[model samples]
Target: MKVEGIAAIVTGGASGLGLATAQALAGAGAKVALVDLNEQGAKAAAEPLGGIGIGCDVSDAASAEAAVARAAEAHGPARILINCAGVATPGRIVGKNGPLDLSVYSRVIAINLIGTFNMMRLVAAAAQSLDPLDGGERGVIVSTASVAAYEGQVGQAAYASSKAGIVGLTLPAAREFAPVGIRVCAIAPGIFETPMLLGLPQDVQDSLGRSVPFPSRLGKPEEYADLVMSIIRNPMLNGETIRLDGAIRMQPR
Candidate 1:
């Protein structure tokens, strides 16, 4: 689907990858809606980008539906939905401290996997009501996964499983939405210079960057945004998970 003159919703748009993507879409002429848990931050982020900021918890069904409806009211039936809202909780299923806390795992899955699906279902429903755009495409949805989905290191059981669920969701979602001219795809990112990674100590961050095969540095948020823009532009791409890693296959840490 074309980005120009279309309405778009970006979950987790307050900061990090989602913020970058919202800016990209707005730059490409899409009317963007920024959704995040941080309402003030979302508003601040969207102010200069010429987009609306909405407070949303993608894990909650009611909150997500209301948000999408609010976006539709402002921008008229979004044709682009980007799922960048997620959380990463590092924990072992069975650690040296005996069994890991089950709540930690549940929360991770709820925010990362279920949240992605929650937004997808709502956006796809909204897209289904709209007529197709060029190439019989009504909309395109791009979700964020992680390289951990493929090679989860130690203390990454929760995080990895959540991302792996996102990977697993792509194809079937694409198949279901095909008739409605909506495409589903995912991007499994490697270590990127987002707030999440920045929260780590400098040495830890450096070691993480060095793990990449090439470019030997953290990925820029704009780089991830670029791939998302490309995915929206190309109609032929669907039902697949693209790795945005810099040829990085993480080792078991």
Candidate 2:
């Protein structure tokens, strides 16, 4: 919906795409709650928007529950929940040293995949209890996947698997939530200009940008936010994973 005066919670809201989405929601007059592991950073980023920030570890059930509870207490149960908290730690299953550390892969799965589900369940439960809005829509959930889910390069075994899980989750979630007037969708972004990618050398960043077929530049975080707004507005777009990549099917490195 319109977002105006509605409650929203954006995970990973301290920086990058999460922060961008939170800024967009706040600008559109949503009562925004910014959640991140860095509580101070989240608080600082949310200050100018007149929003609240909460500290949370999305992978932990207790932490996520407490965060959602606090947000609901402060702004009523949220109708818009955006899942942007993720990690992209690159690793190979079989490396030169040896088999990849199980912990490495586990960490990625726990935070990127399980963490998303943890937040989604909590937010959706709250949303389902609220009275339906116009068109029988109670809420919208837009999660952040990655192009790597489809075309993972050589060094992204763990990261790719985690994102692929998100892709697989979207449809089933949508189908399950349909009766409750909730919509579920995901965005599979390519090489966006997120904080992690921007930390690379300038030439590396430029090279990565040029890999796109057209509009040969990195995708902006705001563009991701724009797509999220579109998904929230258009009720027909559910159970789908829209690729925000500019026709960039990655090659094996």
Candidate 3:
């Protein structure tokens, strides 16, 4: 669908992949909303884009509802939804401290998996009521997954499970939304130069980058955003998870 003048919502839009996508969408004339847990950061990010920022906990039903309502109040019902809010707190089932805390696993699942569904359902409900655009398209949703979902390493039980759930949700969501002219797809990115990864020592970061098979470097946020734009433009790209990894299959460490 044409992004110009359409309303769009991007969770975790204060930083990383979500931020990049918000910028891209806004640049393309979409009325973007930056929804994030960081109120100040969200506002700061939105200001330059001429978009509104809302503080929202995507995992919570009420919080997500309020956020969607606020976005509708400001920009109307969204025709684009990007789910990028997630946590990658890695841990083993049985760590040095014995079995990992159940809360840790639950937390990851809530934010990464459930949060995705929460936002998707709310946005889809709004999209359903809207009139279809060209080719009977009403809206598009792009979610973030990870290479770990397919090949989880030793210490990524919770993270992998959560992402795998996202992968599992893609096809069913697409099939369900198809009739309403809403498309659902996901991007499974390899290691990227996100803030979390940048926080590590430079040497460690370099080592990780070198692990990629070719072009041998971490992905840029803009690259991910480009894919989002592509998907939005190409209506046929639905119900699929595209891996943005640089031909790298992570090995067990």
Question: What tens digits encode model 2's per-residue C-alpha lDDT throughout 62-114?
Answer: 99999999999999999999999999998778989999999999999999999
lDDT of 3 by residue, 84-176 (tens): 999999899998989999999999999999999999999999999999999999999999999999999999999999999999999999999
Candidate 2 ranges with C-alpha deviation above 4 Å: none
Give per-residue lDDT, candidate 2, residue 162: 96
lDDT of each: 0.94, 0.95, 0.96
> Each candidate: how many clashes?
0, 0, 0
**Judged by lDDT, which candidate is best?**
3
TM-score of 3: 0.99
For candidate 1, the per-residue lDDT at 10 reads 98
Candidate 1, residue 17: CA error in Å?
0.5
Model 1 spans > 4 angstroms off? none
How does model 2 fare in lDDT? 0.95
Off by over 4 Å in 3: none
Worst lDDT 10-window in candidate 2: 86-95
Better of 1 and 3 by lDDT: 3
Across 1-253, the per-residue lDDT of candidate 1 in tens digits comes to 6788999999999999999999999999999999999999999999998889999999999999999999999999988999999888777789889899899998999999999999999999988989877789998999999999999999999999999999999999999999989999999999999998999999999988888888998999999999999999989999999999999988888
Q: Rank the candidates by TM-score, best first.
A: 3, 2, 1
